[model samples]
Every structure is written in structure tokens, then in C-alpha cells.
Target chain A: MSETKKLMYVNRKAPYGTIYAWESLEVVLIGAAFEQDVSVAFVDDGVYQLCKDQDTTGLGIKNFSATYKALGDYDVNKLYIEKESLEARGLTLDDLMPLVYEDEDDDWAEKDSIKVVSSQEMAELFEQSDVLFNF
Target chain B: MKLSIQVNEGPYNHEASVSALNYTKAALEAGHEIFRVFFYHDGVNNGTRYTTPPQDDINIANSWSELADKHGLDLVVCVAAAQRRGIVDEGEQERNGKDGNNIAPGFRISGLGQLIEAGIQSERLVVFGD
Candidate 1:
């Protein structure tokens, strides 16, 4: 039963404003150990968590945004960023960190982990998941 | 289908609990089996029996207590979170050497393992938070 279920972590808040973003990442890191089919969705202000060059030194935070780059190593690489959210916030994919993983199926080629999906696709993704984690 | 709900925010402070309650009620009305309600973080505050809201407002804790009593749903507050928040049952009070217990009726103090167990046992795990 370990890898049989579809687990989705739905992030709807911005990073740094509250502890939810950091704590959610903590859960994602721990959940990776369970070896489940983990997928993360960046909706609303959640996309900010992956923004490039997050300077948290002034805020006195650890600046854990870089940890998203390592999610591929844990085999939790499916990151769906809502297109509407990004557009509304006037952000493009170029504004975020480049996260890619080696595609084991294709001669160990590289594959991008960040996927820009429509809101409808996001809803379908939610429909297909066994678990919906929002914080 | 069996559904497990995780509430991560405290009552009154956030609409997470209220949304969870509504979604849960809707799920039950739609003939879904609720496996458990796992309260974590400040969410455990929803289980404190001492929460006395004004007459003008709804008592969220009591709402959950009544729902549990009516449907026999398991309402579990995480022990680690509850201990930090001072939400204790009689057993917990005895174990922690505390003078009093404030665990609301129809709710029990448990561990984070209960949340994992729910995820494994139920068909769906729906989380609500701020």
C-alpha cells in the first residue's frame, strides 16, 4: 500500500507571510520517505514559493525556497503551477527557479519538473488524487 | 467511499475548521463514510472543552462534538499538538501531571500516527487549513 495511492499537496498561500508554506514543505520532505506518488500544486500565491532569487536574509528566515530544487532527488518531481495564478500575479515561468530531473526512462535524459497547467487541468488533477493536502 | 479529514488551523482564528465541518457534513449527506477527523497544530484547539463562545456566535467545538456523537465519527486531536496547546484529557492530565483536563466530549487525544493510519485506511484524505 505504500506507493499505491495518489497523494497531492495543494499549496494556496504565499511563502514567508505565514508558516504554512514552510510547514507544508516540511511535510513534503517527510512524505517523500513514504515513497508515495506525491504531486505538488502551486495555486494562488503558492507559486511565489518557487520564485527565483528569494532573499530571506532581511526576514531572518532560512530561505528554504532552494529546497524545491532538490525535490527531484526524492522522486517527488511532479510540480503543477496554475497558469491562471501566475498570470494574475504577472509572473512567467522565467521568474521561477529552473527545476529539472534526469529522466530515467530516456537514457537518463533531463526533464523539467515544473508544469504549467490550466485551472481546469488543476481541477482534474484534484479529482484524480486520493489525498488533497491544503495549507 | 471512506473519507479522512485533517484540520490544521484553530477554530475562530481561521475558517479552516468551519470549511472542514461543512465539507464533512456534505460528504456525510452524500452517503460518504467519514473514517476520522485528525486535528493537528492549532487545530487541536477545536477539542478544548473550555471554549465558551458568545451566544451570538456558533460554538465550533460543540458542533464537532455533536456531529461525532450523532454519527459515531472518530474525532482525534494529535497528542503532541494538544500537549503544547494545553488541550488535555483525563489520561493525558494524569500522564503529564497536570491538574485538570479540558478535552471536549466525543473527541480523543491521539498521535500523528492516527493521521497516517487514516490516509492508509480511507479512500480519501482531505486537509483544510489557513
Candidate 2:
């Protein structure tokens, strides 16, 4: 393992419509083993990746939304969703899955996964990333 | 500066690989070190050695192979993406009971981790996709 450099998985596509969102999550899970400082950002249409009440049963696809919830278990807790994207889509924080992680330093406190940020803030996060995986 | 490039589209059908190749050539000409070129999704289709474009069209696979050979570059096609898209190397073909391999010269099939490794080792990770 090398240094724990910051990695950002930029999700700018809608899930299910294409394989990009699903495959991007796969990379995030595999990359977890490397112990890199990984953060997932949902921008553009990518914000839909975390949309709540997703039902893929009718589409003959395995519902992978739960996997996003499980990302916290993999120690990938940082998820940033662009506030502008949500607003443009007429979606609020209520429209997304409730993702959270246990904050051990804060005495095992739970934290929200959706760290909503403005588009400019998202750009800052992008600048901080050593590797930006755009899928 | 050390750089890593990722291509997300296949040859002929899309311009992503072409742009990536051009960017890489310019980078190298400007004395930038390209740590690796990792092809993902449809981009893995660029590694097929069996591609034979018409007399007028450029063969994208050969272009990548030539560029890689010229610079001793690591050209890796994501194995998971490749297998899903029917692109295979010699070992992959044998393991999967396929009859042949279509991996181009100077290109190898690898996992997504190779892309991550390239990202870790390089200063920038540039992506070219549809």
C-alpha cells in the first residue's frame, strides 16, 4: 500500500440507464482494500445515483442502491452530492438514501453520508483529489 | 510531471481514445512522464489486435501500441471490462476457454487496480470518455 492519497469517484451519470454508475461503485469497493482516502461525489445527473426508493425489480436488474449504503461498512464514508444538482432536479435531501458511518473518534457516533455541497465546494473537493475516477 | 490517462470509449465508434492518444503524445512531447494508459468500459475495446480499419482510416489499436512501444508506456486494458466486452489476452483466453486472444502488442489485460496504481504513482489522472 502506498500513501493514503485522496481519491474522488466523480459520478456524473444517472444509475441503471447506463453501466457507468454500477461499475463506478464496483471500483470504489475494490479500491477500499487499498486503504486510500476515497470520497464519492455525485454531480450533474450523477446525483440520481443516491436517489431513494429505487426499484430495479421491474427492470430485471439487481438493485445496487443498498450497496451504496454498505459503502460505509467498507470505511468509505465520505459522499458529497452537489446541492446545485439536487436543486435543479427538484430533489431535496429527502430524495436520497440515508447513508451514514460510525464516527469512532466521536465515541461511535453515527454520521450522514450525504455531505451536501454547492458546485463550487464540489470543485474544491475535486482539486483535493489525487486520483479522480470519472465513470 | 507523472500523468495517468484513462479512456472510456472504444475505437472507431468514439473519439475518446483518439483524443486521449493525442493528449498523451502532446504530454510526452512536452517531456511529461505517462505512468500508464488504463482503458475501461468500452475503452477496453481499443486493445483488440484484430482491428483492421479501411485504407483511409487510422487503426487506433496500432496507434496505441506504437505510442506505447515508443515511450515504454504501460498500456493496460481493464480485465473485468475486457472480459465483459469479449476482449481477451493469451492467458485470459486460455483461462476462459476462448479460442484466441485479441490483445494488441504493448497492451496487457489487467484489473481496475492498475488504474488506481497509476493514479497513485502519477501527479494527474486524466480521463477521456463519451
Candidate 3:
């Protein structure tokens, strides 16, 4: 096994409109098996993926928003949502689903997985990553 | 330098696959080692042997096949993505009970693990897509 590296999946597209959002999530889930330090960043139109109450029945598509909640089980708890991106789209943290994870280090205590970061902070996060998977 | 590439769009329709191919060629020309090239999303279309572009237009898939043949490149199409898009190899066709296999020469259908492995093993990972 290779040494664990900071791997970030950068999501910048809207869900359903294109396959990128779902495919990015698929990679994140599949990549989890490798036990690498993983972080998912929702930026630009990507912020729409977490919007609560995503009803895809009308579109005849599988509603995958629920799948994001399962990331905690895979030990993928780091989710960084860009504040600027959300604000630009007239959305707030309340508009997004509350995603949480059980922390093994803290005796299985549930904690917030989504961290709303500023654009500057997001840039720093990008610099910190060893590999960036853009979607 | 050791590099890995990911192409997330289909050939011709988007410039992504072309850009990725050109980048891989340039990197190899400059004496760089490409650990792997993982095709995901519609990019798996690049591995279909059934592509029949006109004589005037470039057959991008064939170009990739030729490049892989010459360089011994690991051209991997994500199996899940390929299956979703109907780009199947003989093994996949047998396993999935498909009537035919359309995987181009020098291309193999593999799992997403290969993509993650490329990210981990390569010195740099480049993605060409929208």
C-alpha cells in the first residue's frame, strides 16, 4: 500500500444537468477503499448537489443526494463546501442537507462533516492536497 | 516525472479527450513516465473499436490505440462507467451476457480502483474535462 495522501475531489458542476457530480461522488466512494485521507469540496454550481429535498422522481433519475450521507460509513468525513460559491448562488448552510459522521477518535460521537470555507481558505485547502480530482 | 491522466468526456464532442491525448504524447516525448491513463464518464467511448469516423476527420480512438501500442500505455476505461455506456471488452461481454464486445485494442476495462491507484502512485495527476 502507498502512503496515505491528501486526496481532494473538487466538484464544480451542477447535479443531474451533467454526469460529473454523480461520477465524482462515485470516485470518492470507490476511492475510500484505499484508506487515503479524502476531502470533497463543493464549489460553484457543485453547491447545488447538497440542496435539501432533491426530488428526482419527476426527472426519472435516481435521487443520489441520500448517498452523500453514506460517506460517513466509508470513513470519508471531510466535506468542504465553499462559502463564496453558496453565497453567490443566494444559498446558505440551511439550504443544504446536514451531513454528519461518527468520529472513531471521539468514542463514536456524531459530528458535522460539512465545513463551509471561504474562497481564500478553499485555495489553501487546494494547496494542501496531494492530488486533486476535478469534476 | 511520473504522471497519471484522467479523461472525463467523450472524444470529438468535447476537446477534453484530444487535450488529454496531446498532453500524454507531449509528456512522453519529454521523457516523462505516465503511470496510467484512466477514462471515466463518457470518456470510456474512446476505447470502443466500433468507432467509424469519416476519412477527413481523425479517428481519436484509433489514435489513442496507436499511442498505447507504441508506448505500452495502460489505457484503462473505468468498468462501471464503461458498462453504463456500453463499452465492453470480451471479458465484460461474457460476464454481463452481452452479445458483442467493442473494446479497442490496447485498452482494458478496469475498476475505479485503478484511478485511485494512479492518483496514489503518480508524482502528478492531470485531469482533462469540462
Model number with the top TM-score = 3
When just chain B is superposed on the true chain B, each candidate scores a TM-score of 0.98, 0.97, 0.98
Taking the tens digit of each residue's C-alpha lDDT, what string does model 1 give over A44-110?
9999999999998899978888899999888888999999999999999999999988888889788
Candidate 3 local lDDT, residue B16? 96
- What lDDT score is found at residue B100 in candidate 1? 94
Number of the top candidate by DockQ? 3
For lDDT, the strongest prediction is 3
Best to worst by DockQ, what's the order? 3, 2, 1
TM-score between model 2 and native: 0.95
TM-score of chain A of each: 0.96, 0.96, 0.98
Q: For model 1, give the TM-score of chain B.
A: 0.98
Q: How would the candidate models be sorted by TM-score, starting from the highest?
A: 3, 2, 1
Check candidate 1 and list the clashing pairs.
Answer: none
The pairs that clash in candidate 3 are: none
